[model samples]
Target: MGSMEEPSPETNYTKPLGIRFIEYIKRSNISYKTHQVIVLIVTFIAYASYHAARKTTSVVKSTLDPASDEVSLNSLPWRRRPFSWILGDGWAPFDGSDGTVLLGEIDVAFLAVYAIGMYFSGHLGDRINLRIFLTIGMVGTGVFTSLFGIGYWGSIHSFYYYLAVQMLAGLFQSTGWPSVVAVVGNWFGKKKRGLIMGIWNAHTSVGNITGSLVASALLQYGWGWSFVVPGLMIATIGLVVFLFLPVTPESVGVSEEDESDSPKKSGAEVTSPLLISSRAEVKDQPVGFIEAWKIPGVAPFALCLFFSKLVAYTFLYWLPFYISHTAIDGQYLSDAAAGNLSTLFDVGGVLGGILAGHISDRLDARAITAASFMYCAIPALFFYRSYGSISLTANVILMFITGMFVNGPYALITTAVSADLGTHSSLRGNSRALATVTAIIDGTGSVGAAIGPLLTGYISAKSWSAVFTMLMGAALIAGLLLTRLVVAEVTAKIEESRSRRGSTSRSQPAVIDV
Candidate 1:
């Protein structure tokens, strides 16, 4: 259990019937271990579905707007298309001269709505039944996602139709992150949270890889199937989430510690946290957006994520398009091959998330670990850009390394850092701000995510070198944003070391001879 105690009246009243039935069947309350397992499994499925649906658009983007890239390829003359197979001639509206710009518009529109919605979603998530809130989001996301693909079947080509559908899906997508993170934060304590969330955060890259493979596999049938399949997946997982997710221990009448104690244990107060604040209070009222931002370490991390997500999402939305356009060893890959190959980037992201989390836990310095990974990404990006065209093997190796560096900081910040700040001691162990703080940090970052792909849409059209240069710059700025926090963590570590040395010398019995 977290520092949060006594289920809010809203949560208590809204407890799902599923948990009740399970407990009834068992003839006892579910144990803590059982709760943890359920939370991990359900949330993983839930968010993974969200990503799977989101990723469909990227895999299908080249198919929809291939002309712009084709023009550039012709201009280059060196890149060859020996292994490539043509999809369709590109869809209308997007197939026009302004196609790339239109695609960018819809992408930004979707993410813009998602970014704006994240703030309110976090605010509401704290006050309502997370299970229901998340379910509605999932269902809505599925509807809009399928609707976008339905354009292909329905012969709908109006730009506004696709824009509106994507924007709506983005709104629903916004709900997944805050709700899932809050649920996980509710169930687990801070002990080795990096390692735990690191393994857990693999859901992101996993979802991306799944979506890439599925979408690529389905392209031969039609691009519409790519979106439709992922749409259904998230909705199904959403049902699983509604049935099994426990928002908090109090909701299910489990012992606060989940240690087979009474429900009235009061969850043992949290006194070990290093920071404290005058702003902390005991009320169950949700934290205001402004109040949540006031928490220490929240602002810097949020700003850093702005740039970090900029880099990661740039790759997320454009990597496949980039791969298809850029020739490897005088050869181009087909849409399907490009889509499948992009999964390798996400495969590397999985390792990055785990490695970042594990490294942060060992060092006990989130900022240091995150900033270091970001700095490393600069070289990775440079190497990938310069050498990736030489051979397929070089492209794969550099892309994997680049993905690891770019996603490592992004994954750590979103999962562990957001969770840590939400429950920071500065809040006097108040868990109410968990969702709100998460919203602010991720919302700000989503703004950057929206911007990155949008800019890439234009910049890449002129010169991909310009786009890579832009990504490298964002990485540098992202790392620089953490300068203050990294310094503080380092200073604390040095002081702690000196204190331990002093304590050791004082405790020595041989001091009597001196």
Candidate 2:
């Protein structure tokens, strides 16, 4: 009765859902841990949003006619049949110099920039604010992505217009992985990293699935709208990331003293003057960028990623076109039907990513997981080509399996592998090197991402048979690169044992697999 007029706890509960959530979070386990987990989930959604934006363009290609250089509404393939996609009137089914070429150019533009940008993006994330950097990237990507759709609505028939947008989007999009990988590497420890990264990687599949569904829905209105809708969605999610993403565990409440004690970093340095309550103490101050050539196995990893992406993206950028080419009863189907059927690959792709991540987590052998996918892709691609000729049903089944194996490595490498390398023990026990490591891996992969479509585009221009062969070859090459990783692992283990027995001493530390 003599207490001052203080508001009751119930009075504070009137805040909005998000505020309430924040407050509720504050009361739970150290805010630092809960905040990061929450932020991570949102970041995952943001990544998914990027895919949603990306998928829209591919799905709508079935309706748009870029081949004839016509954005004319009258020329739009509105008939809504199984496979009547016009792809901007670039080329007829299986015709050289058609949509395949144009799609390839678009892919090359994006991949080239993405690969190059990723190198710098990772280094930059280490020095700059990761959350801010990621936000900017997401926003820029959203703008360019949305512009692709708006161009169609404005009767912009210029293929270059779309190509420009692809380049910009690709550049900005590369920022996401490095930043996320760096942050995640900081949040989690070496223990169970493979499994955690694997589960986290499922976001890729989820994003692809969401992108497909959203794009398909918007394509019903018009192909351009598909781009516009997903673009807006990505932009919105990016804004959310900017607001909610926690850069490190310290922000919410994880004591730096505790984290500093972990083997990844040093406990004695927890109270260093460089440390702060509000910010993360990046392990290596003023980190220098390492050229791809300097990192051991980086070159091979890049080559591997390139080939893997070549096959993976060939499925991503051209599956609709491939499906459109499928002969039904020895007759070519329409574009709409073909485009719809191609989505089965994406559907299966989701499962493949999740399954691959789960399995790799258990095996703890990243090399074998990727190599297995590479090997499986060979037979799957063979059956895909042969079965497509037999019946549409066969084509659908084969495409799904093909996509599953093709994309499995894609998820493994980009997510799990990057995390593994970024957290590799060779960093002189510096976790801050994560951004640099991520950049190196992704930058190398970008080479493959760029080449995959260009190769497919060239092959499609020559013969569809050639395209399948190229994809198969890329898969084989990727598998071979992973073989090198396995070899390196064995070599390192032997070195470790010899050093313990004083048989051999290593001056240059070995890159420990996390």
Q: Estimate each model's TM-score.
A: 0.86, 0.75
Give per-candidate clash totals: 0, 30
Report lDDT (Cα) of residue 173, candidate 1.
Answer: 94
Cα TM-score of candidate 1: 0.86
Q: Give, for candidate 2, the lowest lDDT window spanning 10 residues.
A: 69-78
- The Cα error of candidate 1 at residue 475, in Å, is 1.2
lDDT of 1 by residue, 454-477 (tens): 788789879999999999999999
Candidate 2 has what TM-score? Answer: 0.75
Each prediction's whole-model lDDT (CA):
0.83, 0.68
